[model samples]
Target: MSMREKIKVAAARYPNQRSAIMPALLIAQKEHGYLPGPVLEEVADILGVERIWVYELATFYTLFHTEPVGLFHLQLCDNVSCMLCGSEDLLKHIEAALGIEKGETTADGLFTLSTVECLGACEMAPVMQVGDDYHGKLDAARVDVLLDSLRAIAPRAASVENTSSQQPGE
Candidate 1:
């Protein structure tokens, strides 16, 4: 089924099509990793709303990523608690280890580092979210282990994908 069809099905659960904007956007974002301009326009078309409305929501929510992200999207918290716990130094450590600045993905596309205002766990100061998992009370040692672990497994994961994609003769 097409993306629009799937979104329409989700929208059917709502009282009105407009009420399903969040689900529709989520469905659209899932179909495409990130919501580019064309994807936003298509979502607007699907919902019978202005393109700007879709764009506004896409830009407003931290959940909806506008650009393509790497296999691991790392969101480091920069809230007051995390800042006081040295999130800035943590950010630098990630950048140096991943060889990419904040808002940038690595050359191998394994990691994307970005900062967020909060991750809703102030007590877990100096916390970072890798995908859905959260690492709290971080130090440089933990960061090294985290990056090393991912880097070590990334090659094996890629090889599995590569092996699966290869043909019987090619």
Candidate 2:
């Protein structure tokens, strides 16, 4: 079924079309991987709302990705608790393993690394999320195991080649 058709059905259950913006954005993201501008415009048109509304929602919420993301988006919480718990080290491990830095997507498009203010789990410091799963108490060993498992699931014969050795997102 088309995105519009799906969204139309979703909107029908809501009190009004506008109330379904969040769910519609999610639907669009599911279809497109990320909520690009054109997709947001289409969603707004379907909802009979202004394009700005869709754009605002997409950008405002961290959950709504506005650009292309890797197949696995690893969001590491870099807040005070997580940082104190060694999220920086965890970040380094992820960067070393994925060959990408925060705000960078792998050339293979297999992984994207990003930092979030909080994962809302202060107790689980140094937490990282891959897709919908939360990985807490991260260390070098665990990071390697996680990467290995992901690699085992979908082995990439070659790691993403870095175009420039310089820091990513420059």
Candidate 3:
């Protein structure tokens, strides 16, 4: 379905069109991979709302990416709980393994790494979020497994090249 049609369907469930901004943005992001100015304006135009409303939500939420991201977005938790539980070291391990610093995407465009305030799973401290799934209790080994799995399912073989075999916490 077209983005306009999808937005209409999502807006139908909400009493106010403004309420549908999130789902609308989600639809737009899925279609465009990122929310650029034109896409944001298109969403606002379709919803009959001001551009700011849509823009605000898009910028405020971490889930919504205003800029392009890789095929996989790795959001590691950096909150107190996670930090106390060794997130710092884990972040370094990921950087070394991927050979890309935080806030950067690998040259192959398969992975983008970021640090988030929290994943809201303190019980699973040292958590990492990939797409919609939350991976908790992370250590070097677990992260390696996750990265291997992601690369295995990557759209291209380029995703597997140039990655380090160095284990986390080694």
lDDT of each: 0.85, 0.84, 0.90
**Deviation of model 3 at 8, angstroms:** 0.3
TM-score of each: 0.84, 0.86, 0.90
Per-residue alpha-carbon lDDT of candidate 1 for residues 1-170, written as tens digits (9 for 90 to 100) = 67889888988898876777778888877667678999888888888878887888899877788898876788999999999999999999889988899999988888989999999998889999986789999989998998888788888866764565454575
Specify the poorest-scoring 10-residue window by lDDT in model 1. Answer: 161-170
RMSD of 2: 8.0
After superposition, the stretches of candidate 2 with alpha carbons farther than 4 Å from their true spots are: 155-170
**Which segments of candidate 1 are over 4 A away from where they belong?**
153-170
Question: Which candidate comes out best when scored by lDDT?
Answer: 3
Ranking by lDDT: 3, 1, 2
Q: Which candidate is the best by TM-score?
A: 3
lDDT by residue (120-153, candidate 2, tens digit) is 9888888988888999988889889987787676
lDDT per residue as tens, model 3, 108-144: 9899999998789999999999989999999999999
Q: Which is superior by TM-score, 1 or 3? A: 3
> Deviation in angstroms for 92 in model 2?
1.6
The regions of model 3 sitting more than 4 angstroms off are: 156-170
